[model samples]
Target: MTSRESALIDALRMIATHPAARGLADDAAVLPVEAGGLVLTHDMLVEGVHFLPDDPADSVAWKLVAVNMSDLAAKGAMPLGVLTGHGLGRDRDWDSLFVEGLADALRIFNVPLLGGDTVAMPAGAPVTLGLTAIGRAPECGAPSRSGAKAGDDLWVSGPLGDAGAGLAIRQGRMDGGLASLVTAYQRPQPNLPLGQALASLVSAMADVSDGLLIDARRIAEASGCGVAVQMDAVPLSDALMMVRPDSWETRIEATTAGDDYVLLFTAAPDRRQAIEAASSRHGGNARRIGCCTADRGFALSWRGGAVPLPARLGFEHG
Candidate 1:
């Protein structure tokens, strides 16, 4: 290994205190799964795509970790540890800051840094980072996207559109002032406790990483059912509404803009009270915004009237 690579591993060794990490000397991490099933998730972030070039290195690191953790949260799993693949580029200082941020994120999530590999990037290549989060599935079992049944009520764990607005602000498409919205885009908090609590209650669940509309459509397609979204009932943060006028257009924009890390789930109509209680107990603002229908595709309604589906639903890699 190069001196820089060796130094980076030395820095990582400080945070990889988990017994499975083997002091970062081994090629792979050794994790012991005694009883329950393990939930594995991998997520990646790229410069200029997932984040802006001017975005703070620390926040980028945090996003890299949180996105993977969000996947675990969707599975209603408790995080075990994380393995990261960091592409080394020209910015050494930025890399150091990222290490610091990774340390913070690992601590905040109470997850340890396992073993991972690092590679030098080609000149002028964008910085790409990947993280694999390992979590223990809930005893009730990890909820799947295809588990939703006909007549189930659709729910969201928190407000939407804040991160999209933040991105707009960052891109100069919108005026700035809402620090909260900017922060939302920079750092997303995965609601693990809420996910865990709702594990047994939810019929289907997924985190809203792409856009709410697209992700919900995924659930519908997976479950072989139709998802009817009540556009007017879609939850928007007061901060988002304050920045952009609340309107049908705005709501549509918010739902399709993507980057909201909230959980979108479905449960039986009879389980509404139980779902609400579970969410409330975990400090989540779960809102019912739609329902699963017997039909075969996605539909949207606003103010009790049919609304045309947007041309774009959410972000897609290809």
Candidate 2:
């Protein structure tokens, strides 16, 4: 290996203190499986696509880790460790900052750095980073997206659109003043505790990464049911509402903006009280915004009137 690669590995060894990591000297991690089961998730971030070039290296590293943890949260699983695939770019200082950020994130999430691979990229190429998160599923079992049934109520762990608005602000498409919105975009907090509390109560669960509408429709299609969302009932943070007008258009934009990592779930109508209690106990503001229907397609309604579906639902790679 080159001196540069070896130096990077040595820096990583400081954070990878987990026994399974083997001090980053071994080719692979040796992890022990939990009795419940293992939950595995992988996510990637690209320089120009997933984040802006001017974004801080530390925030980028946090995003790479948090996004994967969000998947684990949806499964009601406790994180065990993480494996990262880092692309070494021309910016050496940026790489150093990313290592620092990774260490901070691992500590915050109580996850260990196991083992991973690093490779040098061509000069001037966009940097790419990948992470694989390992988690232990809840004893009750991890809820699947296809578990939703007709008559179930759809819920979200928190308000939507903050991250989307933050992106717009970052891109200069909108006015900037709300640092909270910007932080929401830069550092999203996965609702791990809420997910764990609601695992047994939810019929289906998934993180709102792509977009709420698209992710909900995924559940509908997977479960062989239809979902009708009430746009008026969709939750919006005070910060988002203050920045954008509270209208049907704004609601639609928020739902389709993507990058919101809150949990979107479904539960029986009868479980409303239990769900509410769980959410409250976990310090979450869960809101019911829709319901599963016997029909076979997704639909939307605004203030009791049927609204047409948008041309674009969420982000997707071509």
Off by over 4 Å in 1: none
Per-prediction TM-score to the true structure, in the order listed: 0.98, 0.98
Give, for candidate 2, the lowest lDDT window spanning 10 residues: 1-10
Q: Per-residue lDDT for 155-184 in model 2, tens only?
A: 999999999999999999998558999888
lDDT for residue 11 in candidate 1, whole number 0-100: 88
**Tens-digit lDDT track of model 1 for 1-318:** 557777788889999999999999998999988697899999999998899989999999999999998999999999999999988865768878989999999999999999899888898999888999999999999999999998999999999999999999999999964899999999999899999999999999999999999999999999999999999889999899888888998998889888889999999999999989988998899999999999987899998899899999999768
**lDDT, residue 284, candidate 2:** 87
Local distance difference test scores for all models: 0.91, 0.92
Clash number for model 1? 0
Against the true structure, what is every candidate's RMSD? Answer: 1.1, 1.2
